[model samples]
Target: MQASTLAALKELALQCARSAGELSLKRMKEPFTVEYKTSASDLVTAVDKEVEKHVISMILKRFPDHGILGEESTFAQDPAQFETLWVIDPIDGTTNYVHQQINFSVSIAVYHKGEGLVGVVYDPSRDELFYAVKGEGAYLNDRPLHLDRIVSLEEALLCTSVFWNKRAEQMGIDLIVKKLAGKVRGMRLLGSAALEMAYVAAGRLDGYVSLSLNAWDFGAGRILVEEAGGRVTTMTGTPLPYNEKSSVMACNPTFYEELQQYLHVAENTQTD
Candidate 1:
C-alpha cells in the first residue's frame, strides 16, 4: 500500500474508533442487556452489537469495495475474495465493560492482500489512541513508542489471560506462570488480548501471551505491535496468518526469544 493510502486509512480508522468509543462511554452506565455466546462466561452486550453496527456501516459507506470481518457479525466477503479487508472488534473487553465499566476498547485494522496496512486501538476510558501504519512507527496518544531493545526476560513484565475453562487449561499456563513469576518483575491478566498487545506496543508491558484468540481479537493490535518494533507469532514461535486462530505471543524483540522458549513448551503440552 502507498504511504498516502495508509495515512488515509489510519485517519479514517482513528475517527471511527473514537466515535465508537464515545458511544460506548455514553451507554456504559446505562442499563444494557447482556447475553452469552458459546458459554456463559463468554459474554456479549447490546453495546457490542450496536457499536459494531455503527463501525461497519461507516466503513462500508466509505469503502464499498472493502470487506469487513467483525466479532458481532459474521464475516462478509471472505478474505480470499477481496484484496482489502477491515477487521474490527468494536468492544474488545466486553466483560470489563459490563462489570468494572472500564478497560474496554475499540480496535480496527485494514489489511491489503493479507498484509496489515493500518491499525488503531482506542481506549475510551483513558482516551488513549494507539495507532500505526505498516512502515510508520507506533504511537500512544500521538507520542512515538520506543520498544525495549534489551533482552532481559527475568526483568520483564508479562500479561496473559485465564480462559473460561480455567481449570482445564491451567496446568500449561500455570507452569509458565510459576517459572516466570519469581523471575519476572510481575504478571497481569487485563482480560483483553487486544489491549494487552496495545500495552506491549506502548512499552507499558513487556509481553502478552494468550490462547485461542480469533482474528478480530488481535488483528489490529498485531500490526501496531510489529510497527512499534515488536514481534507476534504463535506460542510455538510460528508465523501467523490472519485467517488462523491460534495461541498468540507478542512482545518487544528484546524478550521474544526467551519468551518463545517457555511459550513453546506450554503450546506442546496442550492436548486440546
Candidate 2:
C-alpha cells in the first residue's frame, strides 16, 4: 500500500466529503426538484447532482491524472486505463434525505493499483466522520474504533436492506432475513449501505449484508470495516474484487466465519 498517497488522499477526501455534506445539509430544508431513476423508489434530487458536480470538480482540479467514478456523473477515465481511481457517492440515501433529511452520507474512496488506499464517509447532519487508511486503524471523528469485542452472532446487532420493491431478489433476502431475525438482537434497514457499513466500523452495528450494490456504494465502507478490525467479502464468502457488482457481507472479524457458514447453508437450500 502507498502510505504517503493514502495519507494524502485521506486528508483530501475528508475535506471534500465534509464540504459536500455541508452543502447538502444547508439545502436540506429548501425546496428542491426530484427525479426518478429507473423506478419510483430509486430517486435522485437536485442536491445529489449538485454535490457530485462540486466534488468531481474539486478532485479533478487537484489530481488531474486520477480517474473518478461518481454515482451521478460519467467517468472521465475508463476503468481499465487508470491505476488510481476515486469512487464517489455524493449523496447516499437520497430517499431518506428527501423525506427525513437524515441518514444520508457523502462517501469517497481512493484505490491505488486496485487496492483500497483511503476512505471517508461523512454524515453532515450529525457531523460524524468515519475514515480509514490501509494498514492504519479506522477512526470516527478522530476517535479510534475497534471491533475486537463483538464476537458472537447471537449477541450481534445487524443491518441489511431489503429490495422489497424489486421482486427478483426478494425471496433470497427474505429467507436470509427470516433465518437471522430471531437470532440477532435486532435488525435495521438504514436505506444507505455506506452509512450502515460505517456504523459497523464504529461498532454501532455488528454486521451488514445486502445485494445489488455497485462499486460506489460500498467502496469507502469496505476499507473502513477492514481497518476497524472487521472483514468484508461477497455474501458468498469470496474476496471482494474492486470492480465487481455484487452483494456485500461485512462484519466484525470473529463473527464473519460463522456468518459465512450460515450464508453457505442459505445458498445451498436455494439451489436444492
Per residue, candidate 2 scores C-alpha lDDT tens digits across 160-183 of 874362531544656666678788
- State every prediction's TM-score relative to the real structure: 0.93, 0.93
Candidate 2 wrong stretches, greater than 4 Å: 163-171, 266-272
Which candidate has the highest lDDT of all?
2
Residue 214 error, candidate 1, Å: 0.9
Residue 141, candidate 1: alpha-carbon lDDT? 90
Candidate 1 lowest-lDDT run of ten? 162-171
How does model 1 fare in lDDT?
0.83
Give the CA lDDT, 0 to 100, for residue 91 in model 2: 94
